[model samples]
Target: MVANFETVTSGVNLNQYAGRLEQLGPALDGIGAYAERQVKLAIAQGRKLSGERLAPLSPNTVAEKRRSRKARGILRRDGGLLASIQFQRTRANEVQVGSNLKYAPWVILGTRPYKIRPKRKPTLRFYTADGWRSATEINHPGLPERNIFEGAEKAIGPFATATIAAHLEGDL
Candidate 1:
């Protein structure tokens, strides 16, 4: 008996998966388009609401005033409009949200196409000497009602703020 060994790397050759890859494009595109449309709508809604609220502050001012306005929460609190834009950008960059079966070809068949599923419960797990341990688990207080993207989008607004604050505070 002879034992043969060869180095095996983990990856799907896009060329090898071309057929499946082609099947995935339309679905990936659809998800992407849906996300893009939702993000655009979210930003537009934010802008419209903010614009309506700040309608009284019309009339362009000098650069200094503009800077002051930003500081004073005139244009958008902590660049909220820009924050909203960045929120979309963040989601766009998020592996869980932005990723699709196209890049993760195996997920399509092995999993359910990687669509974001609403999380009813989110638990943090840790390794212990005895076994796996779960820390305080907070069930999605808004679960069984909202889809994952909606939940993510809603949560991201505050999470992003907290994240920035944490970074600035050197907590992260």
Candidate 2:
């Protein structure tokens, strides 16, 4: 009696898995949009919570005269910076989100002592509750740092995990 033994090897095909990975661009785009919206919402909420007005005007104490038209506020009056906030796919698997405004970092982190100068005249004149006053140099106390981005960043991990899970489960 003769006995023979044979060994066989099997290979797994990963083309389907590769195809699924290649098709993740749209899903990643969706996640990026979600993150951008979430961050924007957080910033808006922070603005509301901080009681920051869209345009704040200086007080006028004069009995018959109109108050000086001075605008104040972190939010843009023209909606340019707010509208410029956006997210874009920087790479095949990467996304970048931020505002295009030059003053965005200053608004977020605030500034130190700065000088305030008159726009037109040499002397800075303003009408306060006390009375009208003129100042050669005004020291401006910078705005307090608002943690809008920090708040949004805290939610990113959960948002990404849930979104990816849903996508993989066909629930997204």
Candidate 3:
């Protein structure tokens, strides 16, 4: 006598998988928003750290004294540059955090000695306690690299990983 066995297979509907895949866009949006917040916080912390690293303003001259009084700290005078730092998502997978300050790059990456030409060709004058003083053309010694932007970038990797993991697990 010969015994025969029949094999049975079950059909799987892949449409459910596709449906879950479709939810990925919205999930990524949520994660992007979360990452943006994390990055902004990192940048703020970096700004504080950068401020601490800067050289203190000297109160030698009257102008310097007045500036010291009005300014919060070294690079944070009037808080213009620091306040300009902002974050925005440019694409689904891209986020940019930066400042609109024209000198931001110069601050981040130290520059070499460069010539200075004022728009006023005849004479450059600056405010002083007594009156306007004639400014002389002098090669400016560049600032040292502060690494504030690097600090912010370094914080993003771990944050992105954790955030993505949490999002995948539905904990985000």
For each candidate, what is the lDDT? 0.33, 0.54, 0.49
Give each model's clash number. 0, 0, 0
Q: What TM-score, over all chains together, does every model reach? A: 0.22, 0.63, 0.58
What does the lDDT come to for candidate 2?
0.54
State model 1's lDDT: 0.33
Residue-level lDDT of model 1, residues 57-80, one tens digit each, is: 223322334544554333333434
Candidate 1 Cα outliers beyond 4 Å, as residue runs? 1-22, 47-67, 71-172
Who is ahead in TM-score, 2 or 3?
Answer: 2
What is the lDDT, from 0 to 100, of the residue 47 in candidate 3?
49
Expressed as tens digits, the lDDT of each residue in 1-172 for candidate 3 is 0011111113745454444433445445554455445534534454422234444333333465474486534455566666666555454444555666788777666678776557757656555556556655645565666545444434455555555445445565
Candidate with the larger lDDT of 1 and 2: 2
Off by over 4 Å in 2: 1-17, 47-78, 126-133, 168-172
| Ranking of candidates on lDDT, top first | 2, 3, 1
